[model samples]
Target: MEDAAMEDGETNKDSEVAPALIAVHPTQNSVAVAVGSDLRVFDLLGGCAVSLVNDSDGSLHKDSIRAIRYGANGKLSVSAGDDKLVKIWSTKSWRCISSVEVIESLLTLLAVKR
Candidate 1:
């Protein structure tokens, strides 16, 4: 079965902060988790935090990541945050492709294939 972050308390902050959001790739064996200002990709079966979120500079969201979703055959991922930013990332390279600044604070985001 497909899954996402099945393990509990994998991160010390798991208890300190509740998961803001969770998104399982529609066709992939991975899960995206949002905690505080950080976003982590986890192995569905292994249930371990992966490095898909890591970057040479730093985190993707400046504030808490409030929403996450997969688009178009799980090839694209989107994240929105309290920082008032919406970001799109490519699942292939895990690199950011574009970003949009929202005038109003963002609560959630849903990306659909066109």
Candidate 2:
């Protein structure tokens, strides 16, 4: 498989590199798109990019994000991928509330534990 990143630590510039995953809020008020190791979110109501609090090393995901989902009536967002990390985000604050590291390959289906 081809790596998404380029030599400059940025994603590939190919126009054909489509989003790896997309998640829409239950209420249709927001959308999240995962491309390579980056995650882009938009607020439908404001018609602007949603500001997400990055608590990590200035990167969204260390590896390509394979799965993204919104649950709990769009209050929570979950993202996981080759990094073997499952991250839960609070939609309200757009901040990562928790993260779990797994030893095995990531599972696309994730359920938010209240």
Q: Which stretch of 10 consecutive residues in model 1 shows the poorest summed lDDT? A: 1-10
Clashing pairs in 1: none
lDDT of 1 at 100: 79
Clashes of each: 0, 0
Model number with the top lDDT: 2
RMSD (Cα, Å) of candidate 1? 11.6
For model 1, the stretches where C-alpha displacement exceeds 4 angstroms are 1-19, 45-47, 53-57
Candidate 1 lDDT over residue span 1-114, tens digit each: 223355543554445543578888888789888878888888878978776643434668887787888896888889888788888888887877788788876566565775
Cα lDDT tens digits, model 2, 9-91, are: 44334332434787888876789988887888998889999887868655667877778888868888998877888888888
